[model samples]
Target: MLFVNSDKIKSKPLPSLSENTFLRYFSFAALYVAQGIPEGLLWYAIPAWLAMNGKSPAEIGSYVAVVGIPWSLKIINAPIMDRFTYLSMGRRRPWVLFGQLGLILSFLSMSLIADPLNNMSALMILGFIVSFFEVSQDIAVDGMAIDILPVDQQARANGLMWGSKTLGISASVAAGSWIMSHYGYFYAIVSFSLVISVIILVPLLLRERPGEKLLPWTNGEASKAAEKIQLHSWKGIFKSLYKVFFLPVSFIMGVAAFSYSFGRGLIDTVLPVFTVQELGWADTDYSQIFATANLISGILGMIIGGFLIDYFGKVRMISIYMSLLILLACAMSFLKSFWQNDIFVTGFIICFYILLTFTNIAIFASAMQLCWKRISITQFTLYMAISNLGLAAGAALLGPLKDLFNWEYVILCYIVFAVVMLVAIRFINFEKHQKRVEDLEIKHPDINIG
Candidate 1:
């Protein structure tokens, strides 16, 4: 239902790749790899570890929702990142560095805390702080990536971030889980902290190009306005916050994200339980299988997804992939009998894993393409935040549904979601999107299209 007119604005041709270009790409990718470490830890380690700790679905759902709230509520920070700059360190670099430090501290704090479930209230609060800083780092990194990269290489930049991040995620999920299962949580925490500390140090060697035009705060004495703040201004702060709350692209991205996240959240929350309760799989076995899926299959999917986005363009590929995901979800929903049968379960799981790999690739690629290069990261995070919200929503609803219905019936609920998602994907036409971009260039002369 939403149409973006920015695509109509034309910019100069993006530069061709040279030796310098390759160096920049590689360096940025390496930097991304480090940032990716914590992200992977959060995604893979946190969720699975919680499930293993005997957290109920509703409790698990609430925790995820709490963590993701920063992303949804603080999307305003993205635009601020767009408008603001740090004078001394660099535009994005300072924020990235600070965020990285926060990540290490958060992980250490979580690791030191003895019992996640027992100290649920305090742990949840700390988890929220971690998610906030993690998301904040994402905003800066994504905005910087978008601003610095050439238009043609947008997908490549996206690929680097996604591929690297996913690799980190798979490692943490697979390897981290294994280590946690075998060794104590203390050992696992210490080992992870050490690895990430090394990764976070990468930014010391690199830098981002600041915006061409310096703003008032960067050069002018306009910053002294901060000294003028008074208690009465809080009302005005709320009003400004209200106006900044809605961004068009973010709103659309949020809608798509909510749909995607809700569907995904339901599957994630229930799957481990299903594996244990229904399939009778052991932790070690599930860990092995999960790791294998992520290590080999996830890497391949991410690499292929990058190339495919560049070849076919982001919107087209993403729409196709999203549609495919809906199909996959529906198929899984109705295929419950396969899970019950010994002969079919193994093969069905294989198919399901493959489907998940492909679905994630497409979703990521489409999301990258959907957002213009510079804002792609911010938009991506917002989308992710909204999706996480949907996931929480699904988790909250699924518990009651599970209590009232059977496993087969609970999964069948995905059918309704899949159908709805497919319809949403249908509304997105890539060719038209590309044309709209072209038209926007022709019409709008002032806005910087990139």
Candidate 2:
């Protein structure tokens, strides 16, 4: 039954640009900014920069593997974040603040450490810690967004957060590269730390609601039913873990994940070597092309793709983008062989990179939307964990494959992956998923937008 109450409807908060708008935008912006800095350090800049420091393609792969481990493992901490709160800030915000603080300190440590021969192991260890905390923050922020935001507002929130994240990433990478180029690695780290420090101030301005869960045991009741479930049953625990691990979406996405990551990891792990050894490009040249491609394409894809997914459904957009990405990858692999001059090679690289930037962002936005709110933070972490695992698996396999068949064959692998992604998207059926979500929203007004 659709319940309509004119007075009651007026009582609920609506999104706006005055006081309400300020709070919503301000708080989310802070979350994204905090997230953006460590994301840049751990995901974007570190691996490539490490390669430049004479690390082999395999070592670079290892770093990518190391950093990604936390994402897959974050399921352990996700539930705890849901059930626990600290210092009166509610469950999610307190942890987010703490995680960002830890990340800032970790980045500072990277800046202070020098003499690669003496501190190489230390740097990798620190990088691992930063990755852990960064994933922790991601868990909390994602959970908080779902837990607090109204269902009607969730779409806008997702779009805005992604858009802001891309912007922050662009700024971080661009600034990090310039600082690293001119002053050294130290300043780049310090500058990111300052950016994160500003991000921490977001919690001071926002409020978080208490957590709750729906339960089938008490006739679909939120409070009493959830309380009735066995909190520490081995069967229950196993089931929760299994539910996320064996999810239908994971299996469907896994095929695409495998292919996408294989191609991406190979390109990332080997590209710098290709650039310096094969093409003789300078460090600044590499940074400039990447930053420009990333900034423009990433932001555009997130905004446009978010709307498209909501409008056209996840499957159609992903299928289209994946095809484009495959074509570009093939072009790039061939372009390198033919174009001896720096100018032509650089142009082709940038064009190939822009295609990747577009498609990858589209993929990520779709994945985020696919997550069900009922999964909880712990399950959410596990979902991200498995996704990372797929990427790492692809990365790990890239080295041996590159040695056996050569880079061109590796590029062919990407084209194959695009085919797999398109095949998977066929199963998504966005209208059905949207209706399911809408039905849930109507039933429980406070349902999280996972």
Candidate 3:
């Protein structure tokens, strides 16, 4: 129902970047991979490394809580992105490039820190800075996805983007664990810097669209017609945020987003500690099972889940997946007694990971559906920020819960969160809200209402 007015803006030949689906998806995947590596290093590899180095579970939890603050606070950066742009070089590219540079510097700084064990304070500060850059890059990459991908392609794009990130995290965990095990912490940090250097090249080389200005050397001029187009005001940004947060359907979607990953966060924090300290699993063993094998299943889930959401509808897919998650959580909690049976434990964990990934893909694709293109980055970031906050809250609780009740109650808590997630999905009438958005966009074609 929504239409683009070809005459309003200058027409140019379609660039290979946009015309080729493979190129577009590849670029998206590469950027996402760049984002994921450090995330995996900090969240998974670092904690395990710290635990192995004799840091208490509580200490590691505090560190993770501090590092995760940037991601949960991304709502603050989203509006800044929406309010400003270097349009001549593509709206989102400048921010993306800036974030990537900051990440490189942050990683390099971490590698320079002399005594990681004795310098926990310095390490935590550096980790927070690294996460800040990573979160910024995420905001820009998401904005780029909204700017380029068509509505029909968004579901698949979300899957590939997230799947690629999973792969990156898997690789980071596998490689980081191995490197730190055989080599040392310094070398491991250096390896992360080297890998990120390679991945950052993807966004550096590619333009946002055909004929967009390149930084530094290019004249940085927009087409005459493009120059005449008025940018949306701050009032418009506030309006879009209001619509997403205040509308009944979108409000429910936000609540569902907040609930969807709460259990995963608690489990993610506790499981590594339990596997390493309690179960006597080595770092490599944990990485191989949870990061590598489980994530491979997650990649399959993402691919399958993407198609299913597009075909069956987002609400239906989410409902089914969340219900499955509850059952899986209950079963896993029951299986905790049989932790000695490595085969059973591994299999159940894999199933849970797959379902988690599947549900996440579906939920994010639904969030994308709710964003209006005029302020896509800000709106979508707000939804994801809420979700990240829930995850952080769950993670922050892991240590205290473990101290009080041990692993069994932790798993029980996950089951309760999963039930709440399912209940939240019931109130989201995405179809009705989407119809309203589409009708608004069709009426005012110049303004992106959805």
Best by lDDT: 3
lDDT by residue (tens digit), candidate 2, 100-155: 77887887777777754246677678778888888778787877665555443444
For 319-344, candidate 1 gives per-residue lDDT tens digits of 67655655655666678756766446
TM-score of each: 0.66, 0.69, 0.80
Q: Candidate 1, 91: how far from true, in Å? A: 3.4
Query: Which regions of candidate 1 deviate over 4 angstroms?
Result: 1-32, 39-80, 87-90, 104-132, 170-191, 210-254, 278-288, 319-337, 370-379, 400-406, 429-450
RMSD of each: 11.0, 8.8, 7.2
Q: Write the per-residue lDDT of candidate 3 for residues 139-254, one digit (tens) a residue.
A: 98898787677666777778888888888888888799889889988899898888888877777766766666766576446433223322457765776567556767778777
Off by over 4 Å in 3: 1-17, 50-63, 181-183, 219-232, 263-288, 330-342, 392-431, 438-450
Residue pairs with colliding backbones in model 2 are: 72-385
Instruction: State the displacement of the C-alpha of residue 144, model 1, in Å, after optimal TM-score superposition.
Output: 2.2
Count of residue pairs whose backbone atoms collide, per candidate:
9, 1, 1
